[model samples]
Target: MTVKNATAVRLAEILQTKRLENPIGNALLESAARGDLRMDALQRLVGTEAQAHRAELAAYGTMLARYPEHPAADLFIQLAQLVYAAQPKLRECAKALGMSDAHSSRWPAERATYSFNGTLSWLAVQGSQAACALASYTDMKVYFSGCTQFAQRVRTDGIDVPPEFLAYYDDEGSEELRQLALDVVQNGLDRGDDEADAVFCARLLEESIGEFWQSAAGTI
Candidate 1:
């Protein structure tokens, strides 16, 4: 394989291993699949997600500013647009789980849950575009799978809310987004971004994501 392709493949392999080892994601998916996740816990998950998306939107902006002329700038722009477009749906999902606007606004922030955002923001400001893109891909890999399963189970179980609330999660463009990120990583490699640094950033982001899931699981 070419160096860029090899790097992407290696990153994916490492991230997949970590993703499978994430107990919290597994538990949450299994609980939702079994229709055993409590309403309050699900509410908390949605509320937390809303907050995280807001942070993600801003972080993408920061990344765009930092990489204005780079190919990764397009990835940042697309991500921000996706996050903005998905907010209304996410709020509707929150309401379906009995969270009022006021209630969601009043939800207490968990340190562990926000850790991923903190790391993401830090990367946006100080890390390479490749690092940020790779990290985001690692994080999204698990989240997208969970969301797809959740939407499916919600429909199968006849949940009150429209499954379309999660329609953005499994967006038809999701694979495109992945390709954009991988392309950005390849560009970064061509420009001499340190492979080890990119891998470490992805690992760090993945760990923070695990912390978020662990904190969310605790709410259940």
Candidate 2:
């Protein structure tokens, strides 16, 4: 079935009506897209995202252990692997932004910057498979969009980042992962998971993501 028919999609549409995009988050992306973002702010963005990648791996591992026999377990495995592989590329992004090991090691990770990861971990332990899948998928769409835009605009302005790092954010393989998430949502509904729970989780995850963006914007 098409992802459009997924219950998560329908519920997400309704959820979208109840809230708006965070303006500060929008401004952050706009600043990056215009290639006008401050250097320190850009470093913070990469550093925070790198921290998130590590946190996501932990969350996925927890979900895998929590729901071993479920199909969503495979999604968790794939997500963990995907994030692990992306780490080297993100390190390259940090390097290109002039964030060396010494520089980044001194960067303190903010608790507020990790609200999304914290929420995901909580969902892994306390929420349903549908909630985890739907909320994760929603957050992934936003995160991936921001990465793609950042790469494109930075490259357009002749930034020194590696092409491989920029190429990693391309549209090549994301659709399949998205389909997997949608399939998990479908399986979830078939097994009597609560649709409202999924929607609520999505709301919480999205808000945390928005907060991350807003915090990043404030640094600029």
Candidate 3:
């Protein structure tokens, strides 16, 4: 289905809203938040793979050294901070949902280390952001799919999750969110920014996945 412009913007807002209420979703959103900035930065530079790789590697090295303890978690947290700082509206929405900024910091740490390959594979096929903007339009599709599944589960099980809380994964009337994501992807692609942003976002995502591996290994 073709997404409308107004709906596209609304989807972005809904995605933002979902992130605020769901810790797991927030962690994924944090990666996209950081990836967005990295994409913006990379777009301004001119270089082939070798040159860009050297620069990005150096930056990653610095990041690794500076955040020796839970580097990936730290990076995600930082990204969350940036999003919270820049998007007060999101903060307010989250607050109304009874979640706090502290949840963002603790959530990533609570999960067991996940496989980089597995997470990337899932994210590549599912989830949102510049990385999976086009391809199969899988980013938002995966999310909506998940939301639908969760809703079904709730209906069948009659779980006790609050209605407001359900907003995190609700897409009952979210045609707008889906449309917004498509618009963002199309706009990014049309401007050639999509390719660059996708690449950068992918790298950042890979790094986080690697960090998860490291975190798991360290515990072992």
Stretches of model 1 off by over 4 angstroms after superposition: 1-4, 20-24, 33-36, 102-106, 155-173
Over 30-143, each residue of candidate 1 has an lDDT whose tens digit, in order, gives 666666776555666666677688679889999999887667888899889988887887777766556775224734367876877889888999889789888877766766
**Which candidate gets the maximum TM-score versus the true structure?**
1
C-alpha lDDT values of all predictions: 0.72, 0.70, 0.37
Model 3: runs farther than 4 Å from truth?
1-104, 108-132, 135-137, 191-220
Q: How many clashes does each candidate structure show, in the order listed?
A: 0, 0, 3
lDDT of 2 at 212: 68
Q: What is the lDDT of candidate 1?
A: 0.72
Instruction: Give the Å shift of residue 49 in candidate 2.
Output: 1.1
What tens digits encode model 2's per-residue C-alpha lDDT throughout 56-157?
A: 888888888876765788788888998888777767766665667422462436666777668888888887888888886777766777667766777677
Model 1 TM-score?
0.83
Give the per-residue lDDT of model 3 (tens digit) for 74-125.
4323433433443343334345445454223332232333333243445444
* CA-RMSD of model 2: 3.4
